[model samples]
Target: MILEVAILDVKPDLTEDFESTFKAASKIIASISGYISHDLHRCLETKNRYILLVRWQKLEDHTIGFRQSPEYQEWRSLLHHFYDSFPTVEHYESIILP
Candidate 1:
């Protein structure tokens, strides 16, 4: 499985709006192929900062399947404006331990 992470820095005074939009946008992402689950977390120290964690079956499930789909436009429209700067997203794979 792949874990996608993004640190979102929302514009000043827009955290409430951003969170609400994210709630609506969640449905869009949840319907995509290979999507397992996701969480959006707010920072206590930095009120406008948030962390988005998404679990997917594979990397391409997000990079291609979601990003390239029309649904992405909806997601973008709903949430992109709230960003202070574009968030950098990265994916990871779990490491097994003995």
Candidate 2:
């Protein structure tokens, strides 16, 4: 599995609007192939800050399947405007321990 993480810093005054829009955008992402699950978390220390975590079956599931799909355009339209700056997204794999 792959984990995609992004730190979103929304406009302070538009946090409420951003959250509402995210709710709608969530459906678009969830519909993509290989989308396992996702979560959005708000920061207590910074009200406008948020973290988006998504689980995918593979890296291409997001980079190619989702980002290259039409649904991504809708996702971008619904939520991109709220970001103060473009967020940096990273992918990770779990480390199994003995």
Candidate 3:
């Protein structure tokens, strides 16, 4: 599995609106292929910052399947404007520890 992470820093005074909009945008992402699950976390120290973690079956499932789909446009429209600057997204794989 692959994990997609994004650190979103919302614009000042737009956090509430951003969160509400994200509720709708979440449905768009969850409908895509290979979308296992996701979580949204708000930062304690930085109220306008959020962390989004998504689990996918493969990197292409997010980088290609989602990013290239029409649903991505919807996701962008609903949430993109809220960001202070474009968020940087990265993918990672889990490492087992004993």
Q: What total of clashing residue pairs does each candidate reach?
A: 0, 0, 0
TM-score of 1: 0.96
lDDT of 3 by residue, 27-90 (tens): 9999999999999999999999999999999999999999999999989988999999999899
lDDT of 2 at 81: 93
Worst 10 residues of 1 by lDDT: 89-98
Compared with the true structure, what per-residue lDDT tens digits does model 1 show for residues 1-98?
99999999999799988888899999999999999999999999999999999999999999999999999999999999999999989999999945
Model 1 spans with C-alpha error above 4 angstroms: none
At residue 38, candidate 3 shows an lDDT of 98
Estimate every model's Cα lDDT from 0 to 1: 0.95, 0.96, 0.95
TM-score of each: 0.96, 0.97, 0.97
TM-score of 3: 0.97
Looking at model 3, the pairs that clash are none
Model 1 Cα shift for residue 50 (angstroms): 0.2
**Which regions of candidate 2 fall more than 4 Å away from where they truly are?**
none
